[model samples]
Target: MTRTSRRWAIAAAAFLAAPVLAGCAAGFDATTVKHYSPTEARATTVRGIQISQGFVLGPEPGGKLPKGGSAPVYLSLTNIEQQDDQLVGVAVNNAGTVKLAAPIVLPRDKRVSTSGAAAPGATPTAGTAGPPLVIEGLTKELAGGEYIAMSLQFANAGAVDLTLPVVARSREFATWAPAPAPTTQQTPTTGPTPAATATPVPTATATLTATEDASTGGH
Candidate 1:
């Protein structure tokens, strides 16, 4: 074939393949349906203590967290001030008491978080940092996509009020641990067992015979 004819044939083949590739791409779209955002967690600045990425891990998808149960919370704290601070407690109205796995100490200009990583370039302290905060003894059942009012109590920073979202245990939070279910302790049944009734024993009577003496006399 002539060079001109060969070039035209190659162009025709390339033009024909373009529509097929486009159709394949259209059929299998690579766009994601869900996305992870830092804003999904609540963030607020209280005095010099900045709390970020705060959210309670709610029930599994389409499930309800039972009353008197517990839920786990994740949050990051940054101490922007010069002094250190301690997170002593957290309170949720009509929800539950916040339980800290360990004492959380926020060093000056450093970060500590329950999500493991404290900040962008900071590592959590070995023994004294990075403890999970949990809500125990929930007063009411909770579903996902709900909001609850919470208060964080600090040793020096005082208390900070927050409204945190209850994120479901699916998608980005699927890997995070949920709060342990409440265990029911069975109480021992008490009462004295009825004593077995005692039975009466009959006494046997002994009979004595004197006729043997008369036979001996006859002999």
Candidate 2:
């Protein structure tokens, strides 16, 4: 079967159309995750697609932490082959995200993803396990030498060992800008109104009321 056909078939078989799992609850095997470095990251054939260049993120912009907070980690990927390959699917810790790519991996979750680090949330039931974590979302995108590092994961891919790479993504392909600082503005005091001051009194009468009024007048 073709790449797209293969993905649709797998998605139909495994997922039941739920939002992708996210947060620390993605349930990655801690042992397996500790070993996938770019230098040693290996690829395996699912159907016929070869997956490689795996890396785990320290923290994403908004993903929940192990015991601290949340930061959405961008899962980076690359196709080592000269031919343009198709990303069939992903199953990162049972989490999923609808991708924006033909072989997609952006926005981070689709279909269904695990929630957070063993928090008081629901989790997918365990079935037959696959060696070397294979996490996939929707779609796929990669060019030889050119890599895609976004929030999406791959279906039949990831590192054999989980020591994911800590490389930062280049700005050449970032689509969003960081949030800007808020601007502060203060209203200026109208010390003396031009119209009021301009109309000067022709004469003044000395009186107790005048003194009291003058004392109460603003500077």
Candidate 3:
């Protein structure tokens, strides 16, 4: 074969292989590439109510409560509608009975916090007063790194199920610990009953004196 013909033949072969190599590279890139985006760690929206940042404040060090004790849950509820709603009930599985101190009024276009600062007229002494929700009679001990399944029932928004994270009582959440159990004061017992006052009796001599005075008048 002529040398010029041989060079042209080799060039043609290289061009054909180049397209195949490019196709292989494109296929590999499509499968290997990964995309990532930022998202909320814990949040959920149901109906018009938005529930987010839900967490259960853990017990203090060495202060864990036994089964049948109570704990507190904190979360943010945002009402995105123009009308009002109420957080009337809560339920927890394997955690015991859940009770709301009061039904939380979810005003339209507002966010209510279960923790944080006390609302106006809210008693600061009862730590859970501001939150309105308290979980009493815990069936098991919950600590950091644990989670519980909770269901929140709203008057208008319906019910939302949440897997709430248990955060340790530390740093900013230190103050979010459950309030101490209320103590009942006992009344002092009286030592003994006082003796009843004795009724005064008229002396026999006074009665006789009166009788003699009456006889003298008659005489």
Candidate 4:
């Protein structure tokens, strides 16, 4: 072959192989890269119930509760099922007792919230108020930027466990304070009264003796 033809052939081969070499260096793996973005809230769905925007409000300024103190959990639940379901109980690991004042009835195609104003309903315009799930008798002091494992029990859906985030009480969460503890009225106690004592009648005898002495003196 001629020198010029050989040089041209070598240049062509180099140009064609450059892209293949680059592709190999960049890794030809077929896996897709997943990008994660920070979110202000989190959510999960179990059965026909959608539990979203789950968060815990931090204690008030200088009002942080010690270990064994309680906190409130806020979340919105939506029932997509045709039948109604009831939220029977809640549990937290390493946390205090979880108590719901009453079972939460989730109507079909309805959303229930524990933080914001309730949706307008029939009859009265004030809407229906939903109570928050309170965690009483905490086993550890809970603060902002922490997470606790919690499980929710439903009458028909069984249980759903989640890792809920703890956020400070600020901005939107400022109003999500825990419900006031129930007050107890104590009955007043009474003590026994002592009986009155009577004085002796000897005073009358002394007065008579004095009068008799005065009459004798006058005589």
lDDT of 2 by residue, 48-94 (tens): 23333343322222222232211122222344433443344433332
The 10 consecutive residues of candidate 1 with the worst lDDT sum are: 27-36
Highest lDDT among the candidates is held by which one?
1
**Candidate 3 lDDT over residue span 1-219, tens digit each:** 999999999999999999677666765323122111111325888899887567776666445556676677777778897799988999998787876787778888777776546423232223444445667777777655467898899998888888876655655566664745756999999788899999889699999999999999999
Q: List clashing residue pairs in candidate 3.
A: none
Model 3 local distance difference test score: 0.68
Off by over 4 Å in 2: 1-36, 60-85, 95-219
Report, for every candidate in turn, its global Cα lDDT versus the true structure. Answer: 0.74, 0.32, 0.68, 0.68
TM-score of each: 0.62, 0.24, 0.61, 0.61
Give the lowest summed-lDDT range of ten residues in model 4: 29-38
lDDT of 1 by residue, 171-206 (tens): 777776677655699999999999999986543322
Error of 4 at 156 (Å): 1.6
> 1 or 2, which is superior by lDDT?
1
Model 2 misses residue 77 by how many Å? 6.7
| Better structure of 1 and 3 per lDDT | 1
Global local distance difference test of model 1: 0.74
For each candidate in turn, give its C-alpha RMSD to the true structure in angstroms. Answer: 10.8, 21.2, 16.1, 13.1
- Comparing 2 with 3 on lDDT, the higher-scoring candidate is 3
Q: How would the candidate models be sorted by TM-score, starting from the highest?
A: 1, 3, 4, 2
Runs in model 3 deviating more than 4 A are: 1-41, 116-131, 185-219
